[model samples]
Target chain A: MSTILIIEQVLNGLQFGVMLFLMAAGLTLIFGVMGLINLAHGSLYMVGAFAAAAVAGATGSFFLGLVAALAAAALAGAVIEMVVIRRLYAAPHLDQVLATFALILIFSEGTRWVFGSFPLFLDIPVGLAGPVTLPGGIEYPLYRLALIGIGLAVGLGLWALIERTRIGIQIRAGENDREMIAALGVDISKLYTLIFALGAALAGLAGALVGAIQSVQVGMGEPVLILAFVVIVIGGIGSIRGAFIGALLVGLTDTLGGVFLPELFKLFMETGAAQKSGSAIASMAIYILMGLVLVWRPTGLFGARG
Target chain B: MKRFLMAAAATALGASSAAADIKVGMITTLSGGGAGLGIDVRDGFMLAISQSGRDDIEVVIEDDQRKPDIAVQLSDKMIQSERVDVMTGIIWSNLAMAVVPAAVNQNVFYLSPNAGPSPLAGKGCHQNYFNVAWQNDNLHEAAGAHANGAGYSNTFILAPNYPAGTDALTGYKRFYEGELAGEVYTKLGQTDYAAELAQIRASGADSVFFFLPGGMGISFLKQYANSGIDLPVVGPAFSFDQGILQAVGDAALGVVNTSQWNKDIDNPTNAAFVESFQAEFGRLPSLYASQGFDTANLLISALEAADPSDADAFREALRAADFDSTRGDFAFGPNHHPVQTIYAREVIKEGDVFTNKIIGTALENHSDAYAADCKM
Candidate 1:
């Protein structure tokens, strides 16, 4: 590949990685603070995209749509936490999985009922509609570049929130010992609700931002949800730093593997067969990376718990 | 107790009307990512049956959920329990492969509204199976012919890696008569096209051909539009259909696509179908809907000739293909696949609506390559 193409691919990988961090951050935070496996995280992502699409279509304002997405997803997350998730805090992981899985179905069917089965239209805003030139004469989509910037800004803001605030201290304490934090002045239930809603808002924001480029449809979140899970597993289940690093690693591996694997196979195999086998391997590249990570460090690159 | 009583009464009604009744079980994706296509097909089929005002035709529709195993189970239930004499409404080729052969083997007449995989069109062809839609390769082959007509000598091709995807590339290459700059098989259901678009940009190709259907297509078109590659794009109609064109927005505008039917086809049946479809469903009919309409009309024509229980006569009646299709001239090849004209359609925005208009005929009197392999 040419230097320019490789540079472009790296940029694409970073863009993808940054988006994954947005998703993985929330998932890891919820698991860390709440000690609950929220399988309905993807549903929240869908809710955000749908909310954004609906508002954007009605008001013809992308900014207002994003605000609606955050509000709607956070509201849904808070409501779900209070109504359904609260009951399952002490339940087994299996029960939590079943309940959240049900939520995915409900959210999917509910979104389909409201939005209809057809994918809703959500485009990049007019100001960021086309590509822009970068250093060394590389042309990249302005919206995607903005996405990377926004994702990194969110990441930095999240770090500040967690590291420099009293709420952050309480959240970290909860991750360590929930009973101890509850024993203190903290109202643990309210804290849990806040954390869940916050995490959900992050997922929603990611959904709305990505929805501009991707499809805004039912079950859109599930695929990204899978990737987010892989990210958390590789980054360490409850570590934001780990999630960030893992997200970038997975994204780069996926994008680069997809581009190079087929070419690599073509050197040894026929063109068609090489393409097929290369794509097949590329699809499994992230999982294989996870496997290698686990083999090397079972706890993950940044995971604390065994 | 009320439910049980209702079931008994329905069974009694079914028994009483058994002589002249034709039961059709439609198994299709209705509740997931690919639900739009299935919903359109079901709407079109039901519309035709409703317009016919035939109480004798009992249609049982079930959502396949785009799962092959579920389709197989539904087909079994329809055959054994519901005792449906005819089956239709499968959208995907893999699902058709899962359900069609077994249904036809059990003597249930199969009328495919979409998804005519080459296996059923060739070596696996059965007397009871008929495809109202074009063969899976038909539109892609036509797209290739259109590309040649457009004078594209170097092209970049990509498709999701599956049987249908492989078939799409093969079909394009069969008539393309051009040097391929690059050919890539993308992961099925892949949403991102950044890597592929980069490859396309650097491939030095004059045009791009892709065959990502449903949501995948929506994602590809959106990303490709923003990628600044600006290469001309051509593909089969699945991406540019009425059900999805709105979601694609302006990114799909002026892009040429190939299909066996379009709303602008100059035919009385097509015009009426489009007008009434919008009136009934409050939306334009897609190509899948047209296929469903034609399938239902084909079944109606056969029912007019003879009962489906008489396998020989019903099969012949269906083979006669005497229904007025939305695509105008329509017939069945030796393999029971559609022999029809495939058109080149340009996506155009009328007001706020994104729809296709027929630009030219890509292929006339088109029959699938697999037809020659069918002995029957």
Candidate 2:
């Protein structure tokens, strides 16, 4: 491939990787600190998208809609954690799964009831609607580039929050020993709430950002949540750094595999057979990568052993 | 105590002497992913029946949840126990295929409001099964012919990896003479299209035709717009409709869709339907709703024309296609599928609603190409 096309593909990969990271970060955080598996994380994402769409429609301001998305997601996260999620922290994983699954059903149905079964569209703001030429002369969507930038900023901000802040220290302490931290007079319950809300905001932000590019509707978040789970598992569960790396790897692998696998197969097979086989294998590539990674590093590349 | 006994005796005598109501069992996807379509069918049929001033037909609705097995089981219950003379209402192709065969086997006349899958339209055409909707492939074929006429030489086809998807692509390719740049089949219920978008961007095709319905359509249109690819796009009506318009918004503004009905069809009947539908539902009626309304009218007309009590007579009357459909003068082909005009529609925003306006008709006096292939 030409250097220009190669550069463009790499950029495309980065964009995808960054988006995955946004989804993975909150998922990993919630799984790590809360010791609670939330299947409804995607529901929160859907909530954010709906909130953004609603607000954007009301005010005709995409920026305000985005802000509302983050706020709404965080608020929802807090409320859910306080009311329903609090009861599940000490519950069995099966119970957690069932309850969260129920939450998903309720959220989806409630959203449908309110929104009336049709998808709410979030328009790309006029400022970012046009295409921009990249360094390699690739005409990329400005909104997509903004998403990459947003994802990167969120990732870095999350890193700083976890590494440098006092809340970060408490979170780390809680992750290491929840009971001991409680004994040491830290508000462990409040910490959990804060972390959960923060994680939810990240998910919400991801949803809202993606919502501008996609339709905002019920059950829209579930597929992305599945992929995010896959991302975090590959990245090493409960590790922010791992999630970042894993998301990028997954994003790049998925994007490049989809495009190049068919071309690679064409070298040895007939065109039609090559295309079919290639596409099939490309979809399976990341799962295979995750499997191979598990074989090599059972705790993942950066996972903490219990 | 004597007075209460006398009143109870009189009420009991009145209840037992009342004529048995004609019960119709309507199985549809009333919940989960396919709920919207089923709801539209239910509401449209209810509206039509209500407007018709017919209280004789008592409809019992059941949710099949888009499962073929559930649909078949529901059909069995409706036919065997309830002994519903007529069975109707299915939105999904697989569900319709499953349930209709069972209904036919039971010697019950099946009136399909939507989902006229091709196999049933062809060799499997049972006299017992009648569809008020056009054959599934017919509209896509119109799109393909239109795309070919418009001089799209190198086209890319995308669809979910499923029966309906395969049927749609086959229909399009049957009429389209373009050199296919590529045909991509993504996983069913896939939400992310970034990878596919990248591939499409790289494929260098002049036009892209896809057959993603409902939620899939919304997701695909949104991602396609985000990818910054400027190729002309076309699909059947399901790709761009009232059910999905808000989800797609202005993204579908330039996309060309082919359909048997558009909201902007200038006819007195359609205009009246639209006005009343919007008044009641607070939204424009989707073509699915229109088909549902038409289905109701068709059944009523056929019932009026023949011996309503005879299932055989009702089936024959329905196949005769004697109803005045809002889509103008259209008759059912021998296979019990509508032989009607296919119009090319463009998605344009009017006020807050996204609606498909008829731009042109692809075929005038067009019968489905597959009709001759059906020896039934």
TM-score of each: 0.98, 0.93
What is the C-alpha lDDT profile of model 1 across B90-181, one tens digit per residue? 99999999999899999999999998899999999999999999889999999999999999999999999999999999999998999999
Q: DockQ, in order, for the candidates?
A: 0.87, 0.41
Q: Tens digits of per-residue lDDT for model 2 on B53-111?
A: 86667787998978999998889899888888777899989988777876887788888
Best candidate, lDDT: 1
Query: What lDDT score belongs to each candidate, Candidate 1 first?
Result: 0.93, 0.83
Error of 2 at A277 (Å): 4.2
Inter-residue clash pairs, candidate 2? none
Q: Where is model 1 chain A poorest over a 10-residue stretch in terms of lDDT? A: A30-39
* Global CA lDDT computed for model 1: 0.93
lDDT of 2 by residue, A11-55 (tens): 677887887788788888888887889999999999899999999
Model 2's A-chain: what TM-score?
0.97
